[model samples]
Structure formats: structure tokens, C-alpha cells
Target: MIRRQREIDTPHISWPDKLAYSLPALSLAIIGIPVYVFLPKFYTDTIGLSMSTIGILLMAVRLFDAVTDPVIGYLSDRSAGRFGRRKPYIASGSVGLAISIIFLFKPPVLSGAMINIYFGFWLFALFFFWTLVAIPYESLGPEMTGDYHERTALFSMRDGFLIIGTLLAAGFPMLIDGIMNIMGKVATQRELFSFMAFIFAPLIVIFSFYCIYRIKEKYQQTGSDDLVKGFSAVLKNRPFLILISGYTISAVGSNLPATLILYYVEYVLKAQRAEGFLLIYFLTGIVFLPLWIVVSRKVGKKRAWIISMLINTGAFSGVFFLGPGDAMIYGVLVFFSGIGFGAGLALPSSIQADVIDYDQVLTGQRREGRYIGLWSIAKKLSAALGVGIGLVLLAKAGYQPNAEQPGSAVFMLRVLYALVPCICNILSIVIISFYPISEQAHAQIQREIGRL
Candidate 1:
């Protein structure tokens, strides 16, 4: 019976399936730029909104995000159709995300309270649909294959594509430059984002359909499908909470450097070389992803993640000393940071998959959506909080866009950009150390769940 159950839990996933599954993540990575890195800068530098106002607006957006993820997750878990439980959300949400990007990138001209209102409204719409598409899509990963290491292989492909997409997004300005040159004109940030939206619209549609048509959810939710029970089970699951907390804090650490990289390059380093630096950073991640996957396979995800955090903490600690005209030095540090970046990207979700399996063992139901949704909430909050903290801190330090900031401001930027993330990384290592779900432990949980 145990052997049969083990056989039932594990499914073979072909390479074609892995490639197809990875395509949607490319779209996700492209769209992520405006949300994670560019939007704050664009709104502040171009639209003339104060940094604090933008920070508050972002916090508000993420606060709204906090509410929607679990609600969507719950609905997704309860949802069923000819396509599958997860695919319907993926399709509809992708469409919604595409439309929202269009409006977000090209809002009608407004000023004063109206600009903030406009930004907040579209950001809310953008985040809502993003949650819709992302949560269900993430939930599908663990269900694709139950093999412990194979999950890392799948995400390696996913994040590899994600890095490629980010690189493309970064190059949009240059892409705009080439196109405008061909047409005998100039380029702008708004135009770059507009072009990106146009490109991503079709890509999102194509990939969403491809995944819906190709990838099928392998595990069916068994026993009671009660929503209340599902929520209770997830809430009561200690390991799941530990994993989310660790991932969330690590996300905050990850986001700070991202949120500040553009500023770091422009003001602190005083160079028009931010995009080049970002390319190196993401490209390094692409190169190191397979290595991190191998490390995870060898040492297990939790330990591998701790090692990644240590490496990143060391890298960020080095950044505390860099000043103007230190772009090359920063580039070397970013390369090491990207190694940690690669591990953080691939391992956490795979670890979450394992944690979800433990939840199955405890609750006798498959609740990947709820768990992923909650994880999404934490992820979003971390990004929002990172922005809020950075902007608020900088505002207090008298940060002004496109102008020479005071010495105190420069010090604040450098500290927030480097030190805060180091602290967060240290905290993440501590939190992750408590993660009890080892590969052997997950295998035992799978065995127990399979027996039921």
C-alpha cells in the first residue's frame, strides 16, 4: 500500500512540459519591473510626487494586496471547471493583468490630489489582477511534479526565464532608443513602459493559454473540501508559517537593493550605468541558478538558502563602504549578490511546495492556492514595506529627486540600500534556521498523506 501510494504521489514531467510551464514566468518578470523597481522612481522623478506620498500610496496598494491574496486563494481552491481548478484564474487574471498594465503605464495627465488618486487606483487594479494571475500560477508548480529535486529543476527554468524577461524589460529604454532612432525621434521612460506593455500584452495572452492547454494539475484535493477547514489547517500549520515568515523577510531584504539600485547608480555612484549593472546582476543569477539548484539538491533547500543569505549579507556589507565612481566595485558585489539572488529565487518556492505537502499530510486536503496566496501577501507586503521604509527614511533624510542631496541624504541612501537588507538577511537566516521541513521529513509527510 505504501509503495503504491508513493507511486501515486510522484509523476514524471518531460522537458517539453517544463519549458511550457516556464514561459508564463517570463511574462511575470517583465511586468515585475514597474511594480518592484521602476514605478517608484518614475512616479517620483517624472510625475513630481513627493517620495513620502509615493511611499504612502505604495503601502496603501500593498495593504489592499494583503486583503485580496487569501480571498483569491480561497476562491481558487474552491474553483473548478473543464480547464482545471487553477487555469481559469490564470487565464482571466492574465487578461486582467495585461489590461491593467496598459492603463498603469499610460495614465491620463493629472496633477495634485488627482495624480495620487490616479496612481493609487491603477496600482490597486494592477496589483489585484497580478495577484489573481500570480497566486494560481504559483500554486500549479508543486502540483506539476512531486519529486523533491525535480521541483527545483522546474523553478530553475521558471526563474531563468524570469531573469531573461527582466533583462528584456531593462533593455526597453534601449529598445525604445533604437526604434525612435529608426523613426528619427527621442525616447522617454513612459514610452519605454508603453512599449513594454504592448510587447507583454501578446506574450501574456500566448503564455497563459499555453499553460492552460498544456500543464495539468496532477493532485486532486481529497477528503473534506471545506473552506473553513482549509483556512484552519493552513493557519494551524506551524512549518508553513515559519516558511512564509522567512520568505517574506528575505523578500524585504531582496526588495531594498532592487528598490534602491536605480537611485544608487544615479546619485551615489553618479553614473548612467544602472541598467548595465542590473543586467550584470540578473545575468549572474541566470548563470548561477543551476549551481544553486545543484546545491539545493545536495544540501537541501533550507541549508542552501541559509548559505545564500550569508553570501548576500557579506556582499551587502561590502556595499556600505562604496561611494561615487565605484560602479565597477559595486558590479563585483552585485555578482555575488546575484548568486544569493539565484538561490533565493529558486529555493523558497520549492521549499514552499514541500511545506504545502506537509499541510496536505496534516489536513487531508490539497490547499496549495491558500498557502501560495498567503505567501503572496507576505511577498507583496515585504516589497511595499521595503519601499515605504526606504522612501520614508530617505524623506526624513531630505531626499529630493534629480537634485543634489545633502550629505545626510547620501548617508541615508547608502545605509538603507546596503545595511537594512543586511539586517533583514541576517533575520531571514535566523527564521529559516527554524524551518523543520527537511527532505527526509517531507518524504515522510508524503508517505503519511499517501497512506490516507
Candidate 2:
């Protein structure tokens, strides 16, 4: 790895700087669960919006991100100031995100038309600032330290916190309502989210600022702002294309189970709920992250990643055959599948940073933001595809909510939830297996950049 003249010879990131970089991921992740899992229900049940209307608005807003994400990445790359390029966006966007959380979570009392208007406006604002903060914030990771193994450790810790934050957010509504009842007070969804707004808003701002104040951007950025040429070059980078494709495919696979877990448990496993399965899966991921990091160090990141994918997809594929009375079996399978979950999250991100380095080596430029933005698009696209396909297929199978599902619907549910993800994971593995940057290759890329 290259070192600046006045810089120390060490390539290791300090614990303080690593924590500063990783903690914001926790706060950012807190926003995801509430918005994705609870927000629609809140609007539909409490705020008087129809399910169809809420779905359209939510999907439209996400599609809107297709435009905003890359543009922000493009702008942030070109942005220059005393605080450096990414910091300006991170700091300012943090405030915007906080405000949007407040308004979006705590909607004002309104009638039919006014409610839709209020909902759409603030939802738009939230995602707008989310892209604003997320693109630049994620771009900072690759530049923090160029060491390959340390990069794994860094992202592992970051994603570990992300899972933790997600778990925390999952319980917020229930926790608040429970506490209210314990105190002999009634609670409403609006009031619950209002309390969450106060909690989450301050957290995002505090952590965003804390990270900005603590970490200094180390790698000197040298990149062009020409949108056409920059993106054209990004498209031409073969390794990046391969990595992003593989990641997107796997994300689509994983999203299936997340989208259909409830249906599968209720129908196939004859279960009342799936909160236990969800907990086992995510908790295992959080607890086992470091093991994958260690594995990556021993057997290179690429092989370790492929191994993790195999562990994940391989274990989960067995769920396709389980019938009613298989809850314990399902739990064991979920635990095995989750063993690779942390590696699945952290390794791709670490590999992405390396691919960006390869991009720099090719173009003599630092264009991490553009790559991050495109990667974000890949994720969004995968999610949209996953949800659309899973739900639509099941609906076609004659799904009726809260009723005994037809055999066709149950079959479709099992196929979509279990088999489809394995196939996607396998496809992802095939593509990612072809990625070119081994640890040695990335180190050489960094050395080449230093020569320039």
C-alpha cells in the first residue's frame, strides 16, 4: 500500500478511526426496517391510505432513486471544499435526513386528499436525503484503508452494527407500545412513530457529525467530473460490471426469503408467526461475522466469498422440501443458511472497494462515489425485482391473505422463497467466481496508483 511522505509507514487503521467510520452505518440502518417493514402498515391501518395507494407511492419513490443516486454520486465526486468532497455531502445530508425522518414519521392530521399529499411529499424528501447521505457516506469506506484484510474487518464491523440497528428498529413500535401499556397508557401508531422520529433523528445527526469530525479522508482523490466520460469509463470496467452483477443477483435471491418468510411459515410450516426464524437468521449473522473475516484472511476474500455463498445457498436450498411440523427443521436450516450471511454482506462490499481500486488503476482517477452509486442502483433494482416477482407469482397462484392458502399458492411460496434464492445465489457465484482482483492484485493496483 502507498503512503504519503509525512504519513507513517503503517497500513493498519486505528481502532478509533475504524469505529468512527463504522458507527454511522448503525444509525443509517435504523431507518431501513421501520420504513420497509412498518411504514406501509402504519399508513394503511392508521393514516387512512389504501394498500394500493401506499404501494404505488412507495414503489414510485424507490424508482425515483434510480435518477437521484448516480447524480449525487457524480456531484459528490466533483464537489470540493475545505472539509473535502464526501464530508460536505455527508454533514449536510445528515441534517436533511434527520428533518425528513421527523416529518415523514410524524405526519400531521389531515383528510383524504391532504393525507396522500403529505405522505408523498415527505416520503420523497426522506429518500432524497437518504441517497444524498448514503452515496457519499459509503464512498468513504474504500478510501479509509487500502489494506485488503483490514478492509474485510472494517466492513464486517460496519455491517454487524447495521444488523444490530435493524434489530433495534424492528422492536421500536412494539417496545414503545408495550412500555406505554405497562405504564397504563394507550398508544397509537402515529404516536409510536412520533416517538421514533425523535429517537432516530437525533441519532443519525449525531453519528453522522461524529464520523465527519473524527475521520480524515486519507487517499488523495484524483478524478474527472465529466459525467459522460466518468460513467462511460465505469461501464467499460469489466471487473466492476461482473462484481455488481453478481451482487445484484444474490441480493435478489436473499430478498425473496425476506419478502415471503411470513407466508412460508404460516402456510408451509403451519406456524402462527416467523419472528423466531427471523431472529435466528439475523442474530447468527451478527454473531458469526468475525469467523468469515478470519476465513477471508486465510483463504483469500474471493474464495472465502464463494465458500460463504455456497454455505448460504446450499443450506437454504433444503427448505424447499420441508412440510408442516418442520418448524424445528426450518430453524436449523435457517441457522445454517445464516452462517454465511455476514460474509455475504461484508465480503461483496470489501470486494467492491477493490474493484474501485482497479477502476482507479485503469483510469488514473478516484471515482468511488460513482461506483457506489451504481452499486446502490444494483441493490435497488434487485429489491424491486425480488418483491415484484415473489408477490406477483404468489398472487397469480391465488393467494388470499389470512385464509387457508391453496396448494398452488403454498407450492409457489416454497419455490419462490427457497429454491429461487438458491438458484440466484448459484448464479451469483458463477459470475463472481470470474472476478479478477485477488488481494495481491489489489495491492498491486494500489502500488500502481502510488507510482502516479
Candidate 3:
């Protein structure tokens, strides 16, 4: 029987390796903004679908996509060939992703009702291919290194580029608009979106291909081949249960602030530069990310993550009281909140690798894909809940678009954007405090697995 590659004393992953592995995130993120932020408006305003119809379609497709995560994860875990389990899925999926992205962005001329059918079909395709690439891609991370602290650096690099890609994605529409202005022509929403999809289409494939070319998977197929049994194995992972519970709840809270930031800034703060403030928050996160890796090494991933959550929670707490003429203060708070942002993403992922190790000791198998699948489900579900729950409440509280919101609506916005997320983080901290693994525990886990 083949044994897994030695991860305990592995050398530091070179920068080149990290960069190559991280390239897909950059491409995926660039396209993600267009899909996430621009797609609904494009269909509603450009394609002539009503907001209600688009919302329903989006939610349905997303739910379907979430449900598919486990199946793909199980399939990826079961795949065995010379190309390896994750790469084949990623490589093949990027092709489908690229094609669907093109068609989705550049919808064909069609009859009125057919347009909606066309939209839903392509949206479903896009998400399916996205899951195919994303689940396997993320699954590879935990297996990349066994060194506890090094895992932080690894995921930090990945998430650092994720932040950078988000910033670039947010700015690209303006970049296109700027160039159009120089040409004495303004780009329409459709044109702007078409350019984005076109540029990122080949880019997604190129990045995935590059990653496949450079990085190698260290495969050990000791896991169960049966899907139901495989998932049953996952359900019993206590560390993962606690970690996912905490992360999902925190994500629900975190996502609330993200979905409502525009509403809060426009209605409650009555301030401008919402985009500028967002840029500051993400830029600060990317710039200070490496510092968190160091902090994780010094203090340990668990403690580092808790500290990051605390910083973010404290910074957001003051937002509920802010109103007009408080953009500067809000900016300061956003910046402080961002200081922990990279750590918030990177450290948990590193700690998640530890949890997977804990799982391996219990089941005597490596099932990164299933773990990541569950993580993805939590993330996507939380995102849907975050946006949907807050909007429903805001509507009930008397929110009206493009008008002065009522006092009750403003209060609800504050609670969702500020107080709710802070409470979630505090609860997350408490939950994560119960996680039993550490560097020493992980090392012992490796030893135990080796003996098996």
C-alpha cells in the first residue's frame, strides 16, 4: 500500500509555488464580482427581467448549487488517476466555467420569455462549474502542508490574493468606463459586463491550467469509497462540527454587514464614498495579511483567529450609533476592522486543516473535499440567509427604495449591520474556544495516522 507524503518535516513552500497555486483565486474573484454584483442588474435592467423574478431565480439556482457541493466533493475524493483527483476536476471544470461565463455574460437575442429561461439555464451552469472547480481547489489546501504554522502562511498567501482580486474586480468596471470615456464613448452596463466576462474567461482557464502545471497533489486514497459512509464519517468529526458551527454563525453575521453596507451607508450615515471606504477596508486587509501569519505563528492559529474576530467585532460595534457626518469615524473603524480581516479568512482555513487532521485520526482516511464541501454549504447558505433575512426584515420594518427610510427601518439596518454581526462574532469566539486541537495535538495526530 502507498503511504501519504511526509508532511511533518516538509520544507517551506517556495513563493513561486504559492503564487501559482493562488492564481485561480485571482481569476475566480475577478469574475465573481461581475456574476455577483453585476449579473442581477444586467438581467433586470438590460435583459428586461423584473427584480422579483431575478431574485427568485438566483435563490433557486444557488440552493441547487449548494446541494450539489457534497456530490462533487465525494466524486473528487473518489477520483483516482495519473492526473490526480483535484486537478482533473479543476482543469475540466474551468473549461465548462469559461464557456458558461461567456454565454451568461453575453446572453443571446431571444424572445421575451425565452430570455428568462436562457438566464436560469446558464446561471445554473455557471454555478455548477464553479462548484466543480472551487471544491477541489479548496480541498487541496489542507493537504499541501502538515506543519501547523506553515499552514497559516499557505492559506494567508491564498486569501491575500483573494483580497487583491476582490479589489481589482471592484475597480475593473470603472477601469472599463474610464477607457470608454477616453474613447469619447460610454460603456453600457451590458458592454461593461461583456468586457469583464471576456477578459476573465480565458483568464480562469489560464490560471487553473498554470496551477495544474506547477503544483502537485500528494495523494493517499485511504478514505472510504462510499459517499453515504464518507459523509457519515464527516458528521462524526467533533472538531469540524464545532468549527463549522462557529464559522457558519460568524459568516452569517459577517455577511449581514456586507449585504447591508450600501443600505446602511446611504440611509443611516447619509454619507458619500461608500466605495472609497470599501476599498480602504479591503486594501488594509491585504496589506496587513502577512502580519497575521506571523501572529499566528507566535500565538497559535486558534488564539490568533479569536483575536481577529474580537478586533472586527469591536470596530463594528460603534456603527450602530453613527449617523450623518460620520464617514471619517466610520472609515477609521472600517480600517481597524480590516486589520483583522486577512486573519479572519486565513487563520480559520489553517485551523481547518488541523481539524481535517483530527478527522483523519478518527476515520483513518483523507477526505479534504467532503470537509470543504460542508464548509462551502455553510458559506453559501449563510450568504443567502444574510442577504435574504436582512432584506425581509428591512421590508417588514418599512424600507422603501430611493427614499427616506423610516426610523424603524434605520434601527433595523443598524441592528443587522452592526449589532448582529458583533453578537455573532462574540458567540463564535465562545464556540471556537472549545476546539481541542493545537499544534501539539496535530503532531500527535500525524503520528497516530502514521502508525495506522
* lDDT of every model, 2 decimals: 0.82, 0.88, 0.87
State the lDDT at 289 in candidate 3.
96
Evaluation by lDDT, superior candidate among 1 and 2 = 2
Model 2 per-residue lDDT tens digits across residues 1-452: 22232221137888888888888899999988888888999999888889998989988998899999999988887766567778989998999999999998988889889999999999999999999889999998888877889889989999999999988898777789899999999887778888989999999999999998988875444455588888999999999999998899999999999899988999999976598888999999999999999999999998998998899887888999999999999999999998999998999999998888787778766788899999999998988899999999999999999899999999999999999999998999999989999878877887887676
lDDT of 3 by residue, 312-412 (tens): 99899998789888988999999999999899888888888888878777776778889999899998989988998999999999999999999999999
Reference-based TM-score of each model = 0.88, 0.97, 0.97
Clashing pairs in 1: none
| Best of the two (1, 3) by TM-score | 3
Model 2: per-residue Cα lDDT at residue 414: 91
| Model 2 CA deviation exceeding 4 Å by range | 1-10, 219-221
lDDT of 2 at 318: 93
RMSD of 1: 3.6
Candidate 3 local lDDT, residue 200: 87
Pairs of residues clashing in candidate 2: none
Query: Per-residue lDDT of 14-84 in model 1, one digit per residue for the tens?
Result: 88888888999998888887566777888788877789987777767777877888888887776654556
Q: By TM-score, who's the top model here?
A: 3
Task: List runs of model 3 lying over 4 Å from the truth.
Answer: 1-9
